[model samples]
Target: MVNKSKVTINDIAKAVNVTAATVSRALNNNPRISEATRKAVQKAAKELNYQPNNIAAALRHGKSHLIGVIVPRADRAFFSSVIRGIEEIANEINYKVIICQTYEDLEKEAQTIETLVNARVDGIIASISKNTIDFSHYQSAIDKGFPVVLFDRTSDQVTVNQVVIDDYYGAYEITKHLIDQGSKSIAYLTSPIKINIYKDRLRGYMDCLADHNIDYDERLVVESNLQLQDGRQSMEKLLSGQRTPDAVFSASDYGIMGALQVLKERGIRIPEDIALAGFGNEPFTSFTDPTLTTVDQLSITMGRVTAELFFDQLKGSKKKHHEPHKTMLKPGIIVRQSSLKKGLNQENSPISEEYKELP
Candidate 1:
């Protein structure tokens, strides 16, 4: 029987007919080492099944080369796309990533942050949970000189690098599209107003209504957790009221789906009876019976920007005491059958023309 544990760099060095120092330099791809020597060492190492000691390398450099990522939910397509983007960039730079899900729970988010800190991860990237109000947990990591990059949901309480879409502008565009479709009475569906992204969307919705000289009817606004059931319940409640909205602008794609279910059950013709628009252009949005119109949050771009921000901080290019670096991406509107009441093609629609030049 072979003693697998006995395999070491020295064995590869001997096999490659080079000193251990030369082998180490070759493995590390030192510019001084010739490419031929590097390839030889690598080939020998592979043949010998030699594994580099990452823990020792980490200790020597004072960096784990591991990034911690936290999100509200891993199952959501938006969050998953962001993670893929992060992983793509992280892998390119020879770093590994650890992912954690908070399930929209504040306590879980806080605990995850603490755990990541204790694990000595080089940095952290996270989207604040809906129920999170305090940012002291994140501040603790920053206080310890660990860099943090926030994406999607964020807060002003913690000054750190952030990559986010223009939520206010995205909401404004969505509402404006409905109004252009001749939707006189539009209902607004959203989650808790305490969340910064939701608050921004709410502000945009109100502003769009006011811009079109429409009275801000407090009764038309419904606040829920933005769950599928909440969407159906909210829709039912709105229908029960004295004034029924002609359209609904939801903060989530899931909520829009729930609304669709109720509308379909009642044999309501979408766009003709009640138009619908939602945020986050999830994959399912395009596949629905009547494709749902929604906002594309540029999730993958947000993730890539987040990883870049972390690398910038690691290189000391960004000042630790300076104002937080904010990168806001422009979101695009996806026109679909669910919200097109004028029978116009998406390209020729007035709403699309207005936003065609946006980046």
Candidate 2:
């Protein structure tokens, strides 16, 4: 009968006719081990079905070679793209990635962070959840001296490495675009402004209106969770209100999609009867009827830079105390059929001066 026991380094070393220590060095790609010997040890390990003990290795090196990533929702294309970028970099550096989805729930996010901490992951990257008003869980991680990096939905309360897009600028440009297209009484659609990103976007929207000498009407602003159904209901409520907006600027593509559906059902021509714009530049935005004009947040690049920041923290920790690093990338506005009411004369438009420095 064949032995069913698990194969170890000793088995590979015996098969390769080398010492157990030599096998270990070869498996770890230690510079002292010759390339030929490394190949021989690897082949023997493959033949013997030897599995290296990660726990033992981690104990010796004081690092698990595992990274934890937490996001609001992994199913979203934006978050998924960020995870892909993080995974790509982690793989190249011989690190393993463990992902956790918060589903926009604060309790779930806290539990996931605690679980990762208990697992002894080398580092963590996270985007704060929408319901994360209290940051005690994140504070616990920081207090424990664990490397934590924040991206996208971040907070000023936590001082750590962060990677984000310029939300304020992106929102300003989009709102200005709507105004330049002859949209008077523009409506703003958004969620809770407690989160820094949402707050910045809301500020940008208001600032743009003030800059253009447009009155900031509180009645025209609609605040909800920014869900699809919420967006539909919000639109319905907006139309039923005393003041009707000629244009709508949504903070999320999904919400805008719902608004678009309502407008289409009501036989309102886009950019004619009521112009529209959205954020996040999701894939479906380009495929929507009349193609939605939205802002591209550079999701993948944001992820890559975020991972790079973690690596920087790791490397810098050897010298002195690592200072917090903050990186903000400029977001691009995708001009499409939905918000281009003034024809294709964007270069010579009235708002050209405001957008001259923008890409």
Candidate 3:
């Protein structure tokens, strides 16, 4: 075994010719010290090979300056936006974020929540996975007075601060738009309607049909996992039907792209044959051959607002006033070439007039 020397703040303070509190203030960026004094303390710290032990600091304060951010999949563009927002607020308040991906597994989500609780994180921001249903893992965190804010996806059982988009209104508007554009036979391509977002979207689609006296045709609905391949396969099955849909509304950008690929392969003209629209307003949507019409969820704003909400909770006073609150952001529809059939017939471009920048 090798003999290792322990490094302490006192050692750094001595080397810097200052008191331990000054060193601590310098390291923590307390804003009370002069700029020159901070620079000196920092240089001395670097020379001593000093590393601030966050664990020790937490032990002293009885709270960790860390926030746990949990999501179903880190690869998703929507979740990425939310994480960025969380980070923006956290950095401003001297708090750090520990991100965990659950891969849509309830067990994994629970394990990560428990681990964060054990680590004594001061707060948590989470979007529950599609498969998650249990509340035991989250209960301990809530009971311990931890600030928990659920964004995008939340559970009915967990009564905490929540930030979500208006999925129902967005979906309803798009479906009704298609119907108004003379899409008498429209099809809905979406994921499982078990979660709040998808379920709300499906409800919006159904409401649009019901309000217009259009019979709900079960044959026109195709439920898949919202994968690229699912889009292709689902569209192929729809195209094979005797009465093909004149328009299709998908709940995901990836799914829309997949359907577009299949449609293009079959030499089908967009909006002329079968119009298409999707959600998420992905970056690639605008660059597509016929720019994809989509629902802009303003994911980055959602993330930033969620972060603001988390910081508000940390501030104590605001948390007391805002706990058990909910915030809902309206989703905007992005009209593009893929869904501009009516405007084209009228010698006017709907894409130019209808597409607006999302907040």
The worst-scoring run of ten residues by lDDT in candidate 3 lies at 344-353
Summarize candidate 2's per-residue lDDT along 76-179 as a digit string, tens digits.
99999999989888888988889999999999999999998877788789999998988899989877767889999999898888999999999999999898
lDDT string, candidate 3, 84-174, tens digits: 8878877988788999999989899999998888788888999998887777778778877778899988877888888999899889888
lDDT of each: 0.88, 0.86, 0.84
- Candidates 1 and 2: which is better by lDDT? 1
Q: Roughly what TM-score does model 3 have, to 2 decimal places?
A: 0.88
Ranking by TM-score: 2, 3, 1
Judged by lDDT, which candidate is best?
1
Residue pairs in candidate 2 whose N, alpha carbon or C atoms collide under 3 angstroms: none
TM-score of model 1 (CA atoms): 0.86
lDDT, model 3, position 247: 94
Q: Which ten residues in a row have the lowest lDDT in candidate 2?
A: 349-358
